[model samples]
Target: MLDQQITRSIRKMIEAREERVRNGDANGYGVDFFGMLLQSPVNSNISLQDIVDECKTFYFAGHVSSSALLTWTVVLLAMHPEWQERARKEVIQVLGSDTPSFDGLAQLKIVR
Candidate 1:
């Protein structure tokens, strides 16, 4: 039952993205892994279930790695005050007082 709910939710998001793409809304489906998956000619023979499974795998793998990386990054930053300060300065210079957008985050070379 939980799996069904998750599948249904993902399906809805996929359908919505498809609709946006169909309507020529570039901003709506801007540059994402799943968007690329949806648009890829390589995926022509793949089923929605296959895509969903791939997404789940990507999500779980990314979640684990990202958590581990974040923990290590924090610990390393704590151990290295100079690098941490540099990163902080870079973030402040790139993002200023505003919340970090994709472009803003991309501009933060040190922190990235």
Candidate 2:
């Protein structure tokens, strides 16, 4: 029941994003996942169920795992201020006032 509700909600979000992308609203860092999927050749013939499944996959793997990772990283950082400072300095050096791009993030070895 709850899963169905979540799926429907996600489907609505995907439809809205698709419309927004068609209207040229997808710009800057506000890129929409569904919009990208709808446009991608890899997702040809994708149905609403597919989008829901993708969102669910993101919830299970990406969202949940990232949350747990962030929690642990915060705890570890609190225990080690020196490492935290080192991480901050490296971020500034690597990013250097530029918005974080996929390529830039990939180049940040310390982030891994």
Candidate 2 TM-score, C-alpha based:
0.57
- Model 1 C-alpha lDDT per residue in residues 38-100, reported as the tens digit of each score: 654343676778878777777867888878999999999999999999999898888889745
lDDT of 2 by residue, 5-61 (tens): 988888787678767756888652143454455544343676667767877888777
Clashes of each: 0, 0
Best by TM-score: 2
lDDT for residue 75 in candidate 1, whole number 0-100: 99
Q: Give the Cα lDDT of each candidate.
A: 0.77, 0.72
Instruction: Give candidate 1's whole-model lDDT.
Output: 0.77
Query: Which sections of candidate 2 miss by over 4 Å?
Result: 1-15, 26-55
